[model samples]
Target: MSMRFGSRRQGRLAGAGVLAAATAGAALVAAPTAHAASVHVVTPGQSIQQAVDASRPGDIVQIMPGTYQESVLVNVPRLTIQGAGAQRVILKPPAAATAQGGAPKASTPDTPSTAGAASTPDTPSTADNAADVTPATTANPCFTTGTGICVAGTEGHRLKGVRIQGLTVTGFATYGVAATETDHLVVAGVNASGNKLYGIGEQKSVRAVFVRNHAADNGEAGIFLANTTQEEAGALDLDGARVSGNVLTGNTMGVVLRRVRDMDVLRNSVTGNCAGMFVIGDENTPRGGDLTIRDNEVSANTKYCAPNSHLPFVQGAGIVLTGVENTVVERNRIEGNVGTSQMSGGVVLFKSFVGVPNTGNTVRDNMLSGNAPADLADRDTAGKDNTFTGNSCSISQPAGRC
Candidate 1:
């Protein structure tokens, strides 16, 4: 028994020594040290791809002043490629020059070689270059700014620290800036207009931030967001976005947000658009919860034809709400461009979904006047679980709560 106790004590002492050594080692390794890396300067002929390839996951790519008329794909994350400013680094679309990489690939993506497509000179233009992207002809191309269509697979992606500030993004093969399956994206001081689908289509759970940007004169909705699938249950914090101080104008539907949750919209000006702002939810299956639409001044959002885009008329609704729940729309000044002959609905609460009613929403203190609200294709709910008060409405006409 004595020997056994001695052996047990020895084993405990050995374990304690191992634990002490591990803790000490962890302390030494996990000390609060700054792990800073040097930035790589991308010069002429040195592409962002090359800089990124040379970087080790955490390095910053500082692009100097130049027009990089090349498309790029970033599969890596956690790296910062910051231009000197919005004006410095210009990211253009990938064209035939880069695509028909006929010869053997280069050692580094940034290396300029006269042997292959890198040797080709870039002909730069403006957003009008899409008309020139035919298969047979290669026109002097420009970046897709201010507008375009959203492609099939690239609906949502993250774009951060990228500045098209005064530049335009239009005529995309897809949406100007599609942000789906993306998160924590920051788009500031950029101008996105005249795209095929939407200026921005945020799908899935993208916690995006749009500040000091202009989304105007686009083909379809200015900013459109669709919800994710049902497998992502309890995706509550999936997105908590903020859109502030932005201008949206002259689109099919302006700033249309569908199937999202927990948004903070403040101090933005909406004007001269088809529908100033459209907010709705996913009615078919599971919808989002906990949305806050407040402090936005929505006015002068006029109406027109589908207007240079291929979208349907049913897709246009200013401040339109569908099968949404647990929302608040308050304190917004809604006026002007209420209705014309073609465009209707200043703000619409359309419970047109087949199954459930868009319930549990509260709207208060919104100066909802001078706009034509959507006449329900039909009506069922007698304002249950939804409170509408403190809103200045016209009790006579069918517009603005009349």
Candidate 2:
């Protein structure tokens, strides 16, 4: 799919105020002063982790145009990790580790029992079988944690205002970039590919922005966002988090949003995946909803994915919404997604696995074609007050919906 959609122009304008404020905050931290933050430059054969560890808060770690083999952890708030460019700066696992594991490839999803034993199916697991030789320790958590870049903060002390941009991270066992308990985090202009699990993942975060990135050929979702990774909980109010202008392809699913609220999924190009997008909720205290999904191109997602413990086999699913309420899906172009799975369609509204029905959701004004079974499928007979209107499509499951 081409990433040159004009939707990005409108999407940028929609979030201009918030993005500008964030840029201003970052500038103040980067300004020269008595205790001025320094810029640490790392070149080929140098250690990115060492530079990160040696830097103070608000410092910029600038990586030159070269390949570096190491896992980096950024825990300092208001820090910026800038690379020369995604095409120029490359980050991968160490040569020894690569030799042992024989390079990462897109593989079938592992079963829950053999996968990350402590993690839920909807989240990235900690089991890094590919990098099992490097065990995780207090000092090098990113090594065995199976993450190329990790930005972590404790629940009691959320990391704030960290920016990671202009890099290509690949060949990890798990996520290309993982962040937890972070606020105002920005990940932009990165390419995340060939990871065993999710390309980019974030949990327990608020006001996060993922923009202008490319994610492809990952084992699981291109981008995974959730309330929590390890435990079941109520939905988190994302406080205006945004996923905009990204290109996602060749993963099991393009983007998976689980138990999150108040976010925007806008202007993304999603294609050639098993499923385009999944908006998932369950029987939690506060149900997930109140989000906007708009202006994206979702097409040709026909790759078949086998069923895991939490979900049925998924294929040809343009946008699947389960157990969500008050969500708006509008102005998207969905086409050429064909499959036999129950969830397959241009836009599907199915009941949650826990039998929770969708309520008060709206699907309108979308352009859809060539979707098998139906362009719009409302399989949740028990769902309440869900409306489908102004959609331009050929067919729908219960008839007269198009």
Candidate 3:
């Protein structure tokens, strides 16, 4: 497992834990989710940032067809930002969003590829190159970190029915979706590609949902949901989140879920994406509740998705964990995920956990190939106290116990 690095840099404890909503629907769990609210329309000149600034809580901000060059920052809480269609509302900055501040720096040098390019032939190999492709997409194509598609901040944000489909989000400075100190976020039908930091950076966010999204050709990782915030004890800070029906490729990791609790990751496709799914806790913080990873297709992350990406000594894994507890890894197909780091196991449980040893987790009924199991069981786990049994490569990782 990687050493749990965050944007915080060389030093600092990453964050807190994930608080999941109870398992099952309303009948199975208490406190059901409310229905989505009504829609509000937006137009040109009326940029999304202005509307978000003007919108009241519980109101919706719907975007219309146009290239919204303005770098939008949403601080309002409990408001929805819906796009008419991915093709209609074109978000991003001209001349690179981050480059738009005042005048050009003049002396700044053009960096190499910010997003991963097809250099190493992994699989489904193609003879034609990036230059030959029609309507070519620029590498690291973000409008700019501060001036790209939808940069939402604060709490209770929602992005739905978006048509950010056909547009290319590239040449940005920061993150695609830089969500911090936020909750109840919903992002769907978005094609987030060619970003600087992360395609979607869900930092210190809670109760978020990412569905029907496509992320590719970005630097760093795709979908980075980290529990960087701490709630009161017994309150369960971040809880009951889900990532489903999405395509993650050509990024450091398909979906990196860290410090989340009681969440279910299901029905997603991670291919040609580096490190299909990464789960773990920070070095000494050592706390996150049950995570259920099931029923997904994970393959080829090494060839296309990651190709040659590496962070210092850590290579990558299809499903990797470091000091995580009370989790389930099952029903997922893991095949043909290749990595350079010799220790890149299909499923890895790093060194030992902090605080107490990681316990009460199960790994069963998971298919594996191109990679073998890292360890038969978690080294930090106490035998019998933590069940270790029933896993099939052809079946599901959580078929029984681990």
Predictions in order: lDDT? 0.49, 0.80, 0.51
Prediction-by-prediction clash tally: 29, 0, 44
Residues 1-402, model 3: lDDT tens digits? 122223431111111000111111222134232643344667876656666667655556767767665455655555556664444555654434234342122111111111011222111111212221112123212222232544344344433212122232443444556565555666665656666556776655567777666677656566767654223112134567788777777777787765567788887878776577776553333455478989888876664332233232334467765546778888787776655553355665543323334456676777666653342324343322445455544322333323
* Candidate 3 Cα outliers beyond 4 Å, as residue runs: 1-40, 44-46, 94-170, 229-236, 283-286, 304-310, 313-316, 352-358, 372-388, 394-402
- In candidate 1, which residue ranges exceed 4 Å CA deviation? 1-35, 43-46, 56-58, 84-92, 97-168, 229-237, 307-317, 340-343, 353-356, 373-383, 395-402
Query: Model 2 segments beyond 4 Å from truth?
Result: 1-26, 29-34, 103-144
Q: Judging by TM-score, tell me the better candidate of 2 and 3.
A: 2
Task: Report residue 114 deviation for candidate 3 (angstroms).
Answer: 22
Task: Estimate the lDDT of model 3.
Answer: 0.51
Clashes of 1: 29
**Model 2 pairs whose backbones collide:** none
Question: Which structure among the candidates has the greatest TM-score?
Answer: 2
lDDT of candidate 1 over 4-71, digit per residue (tens): 11343334333433443344335435543245455788875777666665754345566676655443
TM per candidate comes to 0.64, 0.87, 0.65
In model 1, the Cα lDDT at residue 3 comes to 14
